[model samples]
Target: MSTNTLYGIFDDEEVLLASVKEIRANNIEIEEVFSPFAIHGLDKALGLKETRMAIMAFIYGCLGLSLGALMIYNIMIVDWPQNIGGKPNFTFYHNMPAFVPILFECTVLFAAHLMSITYLIRCGLFPGGTSDSPDERTTDDKFLMVINVDGDSSPVKEMLTKTGATEINEKEA
Candidate 1:
């Protein structure tokens, strides 16, 4: 059996939401909704869970901080330490200002670079990867609804027609 999903594209969020309501009134199942930007109340309307990207970022920031601190501490204290202009080699409680720059730089470097890499990986975005979205216009002013019906799409399309949907298409996996 062929396993595929169908999508209905709309030009505006208002029309999409209205159509979603119409589809739900007809008791149809929607797999997902895609938009270029956040549509207010969309999460509640579609019953979606909160994103964990922020949490991942926070964890990544902490990792950066730790890595930076450890690298600096080791190099300044244990590895190839040398006195500079009569200053102390390493002083955690005394000459902290000197080490602050490297510490801060490392933290920012890891967070900005590694966190972004992690985000891309987590989202399945890689260089030259094929696009997951069907319509190229989805990145523009279009909103898409991917529907997964139970039995047949006859009634679903009939209900979607009343929702102001502009176009419909199918995708296979």
Candidate 2:
């Protein structure tokens, strides 16, 4: 099936945000929006659900902490049992104070690296990824709102124009 996509380019973030609200109020479904910089409340305006990245980060951090604790326990108590600075290494609990830095570092490392990978994968922004932007101007100073219309794009175009769109373009796919 063929579909028509309408691109409404806006000169300002405020205009784009207002346009999004207006279009959504009119029961028009927006495919996506592109902007040069982050616009506050844009996600809410787009009606996007809250992201679960923080939850994932917490899980990754817990995994890292567990691994760090296990590694310390195995190395200090089970395998080598080294006595450093006259501190007892007989039990994992006794040596936990010394391993606090390692555990903290491991948690941060896992959370940061895993979160970065997850974000890249979720955004489809791996190395050598192609851009999905409809217009190059969106990467500069313009904000572009994309709407997929099955037929009769005139109403959408008219709405875009009424919402203060600087430019409007239509594409078929």
Candidate 3:
């Protein structure tokens, strides 16, 4: 199925932000916005919900900590039961101080690596993936706001123009 989409190109981030608020205020649904760099408060203005990356990271870190502790306990206490420098290794709890470095390293490693992979997958940025951006200039110095037009696009076009869009383009997708 083919759909009509309108692209509003803005030269300034402030203008784009204001335009998004104005367009949403008028009950126009915006599809997406592309910008050269991150704009603070743009997510809130675009009505996006808060991200849960921090929560995911915490979960991942806990998984790593548990695995690290298990590995250390099995190796130092259960398996070999090593006694080095007069330090007690018969119980995992007794040798936990020496295992702190390994536990910390594992937690950091797992959280960082898993979070990176999660971010890439969430963003559809797998290897050999094509860019979803409508305009290449949006990666440079331009900000593009995309709107899906259902019926008449004239009203949306007029609204874009009124909201200080430098240029407007349309495409069928």
| Backbone clashes, candidate 1 | 0
Error of 2 at 156 (Å): 1.1
Per-residue CA lDDT of candidate 1, range 1-173, in tens? 55567789999999998787767666677788889988887777776788777777677778877887777667777786778787777655455678778777776777778778877997789879888787888889899999875456666776666778888886665
The candidate with the higher lDDT, 1 or 3, is 3
- Name the TM-score of candidate 3: 0.96
Instruction: State residue 11's C-alpha deviation in candidate 3, in Å.
Output: 0.4
User: Which stretches in model 2 have alpha-carbon errors above 4 Å?
Assistant: none
| Tens digit of per-residue lDDT, candidate 2, span 117-163 | 89999988977888989788888999999999987889899999999
Note the Cα lDDT for every prediction shown: 0.77, 0.91, 0.92
lDDT of 2 at 150: 85
TM-score of each: 0.80, 0.96, 0.96
Error of 1 at 155 (Å): 2.2
Single out the weakest 10-residue window by summed lDDT for candidate 3: 74-83
